[model samples]
Target: MALRITDECINCDVCEPQCPNTAISMGPEHYIIDPDRCTECVGHFDEPQCQVFCPVECIEVDPDHTEDRETLEAKFRRLAVS
Candidate 1:
């Protein structure tokens, strides 16, 4: 699943640099994650990098964008190949 920054986000910019896929970006209100680029850190890390670094715990899985492990892996693979 892709993570979404909550309104609780402080816009600290801490999470931006932590994303290996460059999925996270600045928003007018808060940081945003591009779902097309988000692999939940599967291709690059053992865990979600953004979740680990978000100071306010604002990063959480988007239930609406949920995907199985295989799908997530495939998504990462596609990104890698591209």
Candidate 2:
């Protein structure tokens, strides 16, 4: 599933550059992830880099935009192709 940053985020900017899919972006309130672009690093890394780098542990699976691993991989593949 795609990951999202919560309001608890400290805005430390630690997770931004760590996202393999470049899905994380600065938001009006907190760092945000584009679900369409996020693959939880399935096609890029062994784990979610954002979650790893976030010192506040505010990154979590996006419940509102839940997706299976296969779907995430498909999205990754599509992004790679284009």
Candidate 3:
């Protein structure tokens, strides 16, 4: 599943650079994750880098944009070639 930044985010700017797919971006109020570009780091790492580095633990799976591991891996591959 794709991850999302919650309102609990402190806007620390730590999670943005950690995303392998470059899915995290600064939104109007806080950081936001693009579900289209998010792959949960399946192809890049064993775990999600953003979540690992996030100090406040505000990143969580996006329930509304849920996806399986295989789908995330496919997305990662697509991102790699593009």
Q: Estimate each model's TM-score.
A: 0.94, 0.93, 0.97
Ten-residue stretch with the least lDDT total in model 2: 15-24
lDDT of 1 by residue, 26-59 (tens): 8888889998889999979999989998878999
Candidates 2 and 3, the one with greater TM-score: 3
- lDDT at 40, model 3: 90
**What's the TM for model 1?**
0.94
Instruction: State the C-alpha lDDT per candidate.
Output: 0.89, 0.88, 0.93
Runs of candidate 3 exceeding 4 Å displacement: none
Local lDDT at 14 for model 2: 90
**Who wins the lDDT comparison?**
3
Candidate order (TM-score): 3, 1, 2
Q: Please, what are the lDDT tens digits per residue for candidate 2 over residues 1-82?
A: 7888889998898988988778888899888999989999998988999888788899999888889889988999998987
Clashing pairs for predicted structure model 2, backbone only = none
